[model samples]
Target chain A: GAGVSQSPSNKVTEKGKDVELRCDPISGHTALYWYRQRLGQGLEFLIYFQGNSAPDKSGLPSDRFSAERTGESVSTLTIQRTQQEDSAVYLCASSPGQGAIEQFFGPGTRLTVL
Target chain B: DQQVKQNSPSLSVQEGRISILNCDYTNSMFDYFLWYKKYPAEGPTFLISISSIKDKNEDGRFTVFLNKSAKHLSLHIVPSQPGDSAVYFCAASSGTSGTYKYIFGTGTRLKVLA
Candidate 1:
């Protein structure tokens, strides 16, 4: 893991329950990303993976959002009925698929819902 | 719709000076550009990047500037410190046919006031 890693750093839940959030990337990093940061705003991508395949989920945000990744190195982002604007923070990143390169982050998870 | 826009949410430099941060994009097919730095719950690091055939890019104290005819881009942090405050994001990348991602902006919270 030398870098990206995310999990229950914080979570509240109440609105409609249902939540899951996890990410651990940066071992050979074949892309992988997911973002969402509300409060002060900025960063909202939501999906992107390469090795585990996910050309780009066009930035979820509906259908209760969804995400998945496998051997490419753990990733998960379900969020079924949660609301309260879905709270904030949930970030995770990794890269090395080249092209523009540079990404590597993960210290987030802070959903709230309530 | 919000391709990328950081209309200044906050900024207050002082420690040593120079903090400029701004970004705007309407998509000219992007062409790659980046600048990130967040720190509250962590997540978000990469700090400089620019390539649209290059307008400018630096590292040390950070510097990035590009203006693809006005799509605009900026980020300069000369001496400003206080650990450089935080929250600064601006990203854009397009590369369609072969697939690519990254699009962020809605941050600017530098405070650095030593």
Candidate 2:
């Protein structure tokens, strides 16, 4: 079975530009999540989607960060007006359902805001 | 404030030796804990987990021990191998709070000498 996958394995952009990172969860997964890992830091939760309910955006650090998932499959995390602080490895993960304990993760997209 | 903490930044062990990694949390609400292993340029993979109700959970050579009263957890690997060398992260979540999000700690890099 295919594990979760992310596109544009590495992206470098100017500080003011906007970047969109894509994630493809494993087939049939109903819960998806986005997280960020800065240098020497832990994985920071960004947002998550479960079924058709409103996405959990509590972890979004600021309004500039947003994410959308079409149904239960692909998800895109967008950062508007990127800053150097936004440079990090953006990871996506999915699980069987909302309460599932184990999550399958993608390789992640490394975004460098220059 | 950081809720989860992995005090050790790195650890080294000889092959066939025991490797132990520890994690601590400031939040008493966390009831579920998980351990993940990650390689360079890759996303984290789920390794093991333990619930607050259980003091320990074991799987093969990997075991996770939880101490709710101390707000701490530990992952132990017996007879460690070189393949087990990587960055290990511990995550905590408050399942009883009805949120499916996890708070991760700064990873601990383990080096298993062959």
Candidate 3:
């Protein structure tokens, strides 16, 4: 089966530009998540979507960061007015559903803001 | 604050030897812990996990041990292989139900010498 996957393996954008990272979760996965991995840093939770419930956006670092998921299949993370600080690998993951423990991750989209 | 911490930046083990990776957490609300392995240019794959109530969980050659009192956990791989060289991440979550807000630690790079 196909695992989670991300598009634009690498993105080089200028500061103040907006970029969208896409993610396709595994089939039948109802829970999806987004995280950011900065250089020499841990993965920081960004947002989460489970079934039809309201998405959890508590992890978004700033108002410029946001994410959306269509039902339970695909997700996208968007950064408005990108900053150099936003340069990092954006990762997406998914699980079977609520109460599921394991989350399968995507290769990630490396966003480089110059 | 760093809720989870992987103290060792990297570790090396000879093939056919034991490989141990350590992680610590500062949040008492975390009830589930998971380990993930990632190779270059690839996504992270779920390895093993342990519940807060349990002290240990084993799966084939992989085992996860949790010390809730010390807020610590470790992943042990027996007969480490050269293919096992990659980054290992430790993640924790507070609730096991609807919310999938995971706190991850900085990954530890592992090298297996053949």
Candidate 4:
């Protein structure tokens, strides 16, 4: 079966620029999540979307990071005014349903803020 | 503060040997624990999982052991192969909380030397 997918395998952008990362979850998946991994750090939860429920933005580090998921399909994570600290690999994941323990992940998009 | 923590940054094990990866959590509410493996240029893939109700779960060569009293969990891979070299991440979620968010630990890099 098709797994989660992300666009722009790699992106290098200038500071203060805005970058949008896209994620296509597996077909029929009702839960989607976005995470970021900084250099030598753990995967940090950014946001989560489950069906039509309110998205969880508690893990977002700052107000500049926001994500939108259309129904149970595609999702986009936008970072406003990118900074050097924003450089990291953005990963997307999806599960069969809400509260599902196992999650399938995408290849991820590596964003380099230069 | 990091709710999940992987104290070891890296580990090296000889091929065909047993590999053990450890994780700790500060949140007692976490009732579900999962382990994920990741290779370079890819997102994490679910490896194994265990619920707080059970002390252990095993699939093939992978086994996950959970200790609710200690707030710790470990993943054991028997007969580790060179292909097993990658980063391993541990995640925890509180199912009773009704939130779909998961707290991930900093990953541990595993190097299986042949």
Write the candidate numbers in order of decreasing lDDT.
2, 4, 3, 1
lDDT (10s digit) by residue, model 1, range B33-103: 88888888788888778879899888898889898999898988898889989888888887654344778
Give the higher-TM-score candidate: 1 or 4. 4
Instruction: Provide the overall lDDT of each model, using Cα atoms, as 2-decimal numbers.
Output: 0.85, 0.95, 0.92, 0.93
Question: Best DockQ goes to which candidate?
Answer: 3
- The most accurate candidate by TM-score is 2
TM-score of chain A of each: 0.32, 0.98, 0.98, 0.98
lDDT of 1 at A11: 92
lDDT of 3 by residue, B1-114 (tens): 899999999999999999999999999989999999989888888898888989999999899999988999999999899999999999999874657578899999999999
TM-score of 4: 0.97
Model 2 segments beyond 4 Å from truth? none
Write one digit per residue (lDDT tens) for candidate 1, span A16-103.
8899999999898788888888887777887887875545787887988898888688889999989999899889897877453588
Using TM-score as the measure, name the better of candidate 2 and candidate 3: 2
lDDT of 3 at B96: 49
**lDDT (Cα, tens digit) per residue for candidate 3, span A14-73:** 999999999999999999999999999989988889999899888899999988899878
For model 4, how big is the iRMS in angstroms? 1.3
**Deviation in Å, model 3, residue A79 alpha carbon:** 0.6
TM-score for candidate 3 = 0.97
Clashes of 1: 0
DockQ values per model: 0.27, 0.80, 0.81, 0.78
